[model samples]
Target: MKILFLSLVKVNSLSDRGIYTDLLREFVSQGHHVTAVTPVERRDSNSAKIEVEKGFTNLHVRTLNIQKTNFIEKGLGMLLIGRQFLRAINSNLSGEKFDVILYSTPPITLYSTVRKLKHSMNSHTYLLLKDIFPQNAIDMKMMKKDGILHKYFKSIERKLYNISDHIGCMSPANVNFIKEYHKYVSTDKIHVNPNSIEPIIQTISSKDRELIRADYELPLDKSILVYGGNLGIPQGIDFLIEILENVKLENVHYLIVGSGSEYQKLKNWCDQNKSDHVTLLKFLPKEKYDKLLSSCDIGLILLNKNFLIPNFPSRLLSYLEMGLPVLSATDPNTDIGDILEYNKCGKKVLAGDVISFKTALNELLSSSSKYQEYSNNAKKLLLQDYDVVNSVQIIVDRVEQVKFNQNV
Candidate 1:
């Protein structure tokens, strides 16, 4: 099968711990051709856009002049990216046919490019619905329901949904929310395609882990709780600062390993609050991240309470694969909370619940036996369910099934 991926993020290597890479590798491994269409520069990258390729899947980075200095500029950039991508496809891929076109969303305004590519390449489109759009904006009070921006966003969102052959959501909660909003979309067509974690990097040994930590100035003596990947809108700086002020566990240090648009804001907040237990670091290379996560004691997830959407961050899966229990500080009704509770994979507290968050940490800190149990469960569940091999198989099988059904 020849698959074309339309993603907002651009990376050189296709083995990174995200949806774009996860699925790309899966297709390539199954002897399929996969080409990802991504931005000139990663919108999420705080440092610089790095091109990477490791096993089979190769990334095709598309350049775009994203004038996203401000909100209006950002909106216009998104519009142009989707608008311009269509032109790129029409000219470059008109002769090349694709078996499937996987389009991810958040900007939720890629109808022109996706629709054009769908017909131009004569491909079946799959909407990998990661975030709920205009509704998420409304939840954050960034936009209003009946406002002009809301209407415009909703318009593009509907067009994207209307044209797609399948809508794959990360969580059942999101599937439900999307259905509630868009009754026209058939529930049968909604697939739960989760954010999967690839296996841990096996090349790094215990000695290698020790040396890497020493190089990074990581405290190997104390237990390190890593909060890796993304430090932006969903995980607010205010909520994280409150956690630092509230949770005062002993012999445990918090290592936040990633940089985002809000990294400086969080850094300033840490300095102002005089947070001694917490340390912030920029995004590490994939190899280093694998080494660090393989050695970490605990992993943390932090999100604002206002986020009603079920956003299961891909980082959690990485934490689990390392056999580390999660300290999932997220919303009350998110997929993360449910997974942690059901799988017995560590503690979960509603976001902004400083008291509960502190208490949960205290419980895990005080009881070594309980911590071990949760950690073991996390590793067990990671092996059983969240493994990328299993997820990829499901995706491949399902795509074939969808194809068969379409034929029938």
Candidate 2:
């Protein structure tokens, strides 16, 4: 099958590991010809071009910087990105036809582009519902609910859903949210297709862990609780600071390694309350980050308590891949905490509940036997539920089913 994947993530090569790249690699391994259309943001100073590689082609469309920029630019960039992508596709791949059009939510501005391609190539469109928009924006208080911008994006969201032949949500909670709010969407079209990756299975030796921790100035004797991802508003940064301010455990340490809009805020707090227990660092490269993550004893996840949308962060896969038990402080709406508890891989507490968070942390840190059990369960859960092969198979099955229905 000829597959076209649309995403905001910049993928320079399939050799790099990430959820989207891993999924695309799986498609290539399954004998599918994949064309991934991705952005080359203005900050990168790259021109639009197409690179043909083994098993797939990557079309890089130049656009305004949509990530880690001011709100005006990000908003404008998303608004204009779809048109930019369509023009690039027509110019470079005019002769190409796609069997399946697979795209993920983020911008949600690809409605016109997807509609045009689906009609032109007679392709089946699949929506990888990673982030629910407008609502999330409202949740962050970035956009006012029922305001002009919200109403505008809401219409686009509906159009995007309407054009999609299938919508693959990240979890059961997401599927339920969509079903309840978007009653016009058919239930048959929605299914759980989680954030998956081709997990690299390896363990850092005790010596290596100690070395890595020493390199980062992290104490080897303490149980390191690491939060290694975007430090943005959606992550409930205030609550994380609260935990740091109040946590008095001598055997526990906090390691935060990421850069985002909220990085400065967290840095300011860390500066004011300088302590030996907490270490804050900027984002590291993937290889280095993974090594640092493996050196840590626990993985941390945080979400803003106000979110109505269930956001399943892809960072969970990284933590699980390393066999580190997760500790999530998230909004009540997301089921990430539920999954962690059900699999016995970790624990979760409501965001802003510092007491519960500390208690769970103590439980995970108190018993070595229980920690090992949770660690083992983490790896098992990754293999059974979050593997990229499963995601690839689910998409292929859905595409085939769509084909059969069209024929019937």
Candidate 3:
């Protein structure tokens, strides 16, 4: 099958280890031709280019920088990005026809493009619902519910959902949330197709872990709780810092390694506190980051307490792949914590509940046997459920079913 994958992220290689790249690689491995349309957001210039890679073709459309920048600029860029992307696709791949169209969210501006592709090529459209946007924006107080911008984006969101033949949500909570609030979307159309990856099971020797810890200035004697991902508003950085400030666990060290809009805020708090128990570092290269991750004892997941939208973080897969037990501090609405608890691989604390967060950390530190059990469970669950191969099969099966129904 000829598959067209569209996303806002710039994916240069299918060889790279990411949610999209891993999934697309599986499609290629299954004898399907996958072409991805991504953005190459530039600050100084505006241009688009296409690159032919080994397993797939990448069409990089130049647009305004929308990530890690000022909110106003990103907002304007997002507003115009859909039109820019549609033009780029029509210009370059006008002759190409795809059997299926797959895309993910953040821009939610691709409704027109997907509609055009689905109509022109007679293709089935699948939406990988990674985000629920305007609501999330409202949760973070970035946008107001009755505001003009909010209403406009909500319309785009609805159109995107309406055009999708199938929508794959991250978890059951997401499925429920979408089905309940988005009554316009059929519940049968939404299924749990989580953030999956082609697992790279790399084991770390004890001595190697020690060496890496020493090199990275990480404490060898302490049980390290590492949070390695975007440190933005949605993550509830203030709550993360609050937990950090209140955590009195002497044996458990905190290692935060990521950069985003809230990096400076966290950095300021770290500098002012001048505590040796916490280490705040900028994002590292994948190899080094993975090494550091393997050296940690526990993985930390954070979400804003005000969230009405449930977020399923992809970072959970990374921690599970490394056999590290997760400890998520998230909003009450998110079901990631529930999933973790059900898998018996982690514990969850409500976001902003510093006391619970600290108690959970202490409990994990107190019981080595419990830690080992959780770690093993995490790895086992990843192998059983979150593999990209399984996710790819699910997506392909859905597409085939959609096609069959269309024929019937």
lDDT-best of 1 and 2: 2
lDDT of 2 by residue, 1-408 (tens): 999999999989998999999999999998999999999999996787899988899999999999988879998999999999999999999989999999998879999999999999999999999999989999999999999999999999999999999999999999999999999998899999999999888987899989998998889889889999999999989999899989779999899999998999999988887877899999999989998998988999999999999999999999999999999999999999999999999999999998998899999988999999999999999999999999999989998887898899
**Runs with alpha carbons beyond 4 Å of true place in candidate 1:** 15-17, 42-62, 65-69, 201-212
Top candidate when judged by lDDT against the true structure: 2
Question: How accurate locally is residue 336 in candidate 3, as Cα lDDT from 0 to 100?
Answer: 90
- The number of residue pairs in model 1 that clash at the backbone is 4
**Ranking of all predicted structures according to lDDT, beginning with the best and ending with the worst:** 2, 3, 1
Candidate 1 has which clashing residue pairs, if any?
12-51, 12-52, 13-52, 13-53
Q: Give the lDDT of residue 128 in candidate 2.
A: 96
lDDT digits (tens) for residues 1-408 of candidate 3: 889998888887788888899999999998988998888887746467788866588898888888877878887888778788889888998888898899998769878888988999989899999999889989999888879989998898999999998899988999999989999997778999999998888788999999999988998899889999999989989988887877858788999999988999999998998989899999998878888899999999999899999999999999999999899999899999898889999899999888888788777777889889999899998988899998889888998887788789
Alpha-carbon shift of residue 84 in model 1 (angstroms): 1.8
Assess each prediction's global lDDT (C-alpha) against the native.
0.74, 0.93, 0.89
Which residue pairs come into collision in candidate 3? none
lDDT of the structure predicted as candidate 1: 0.74
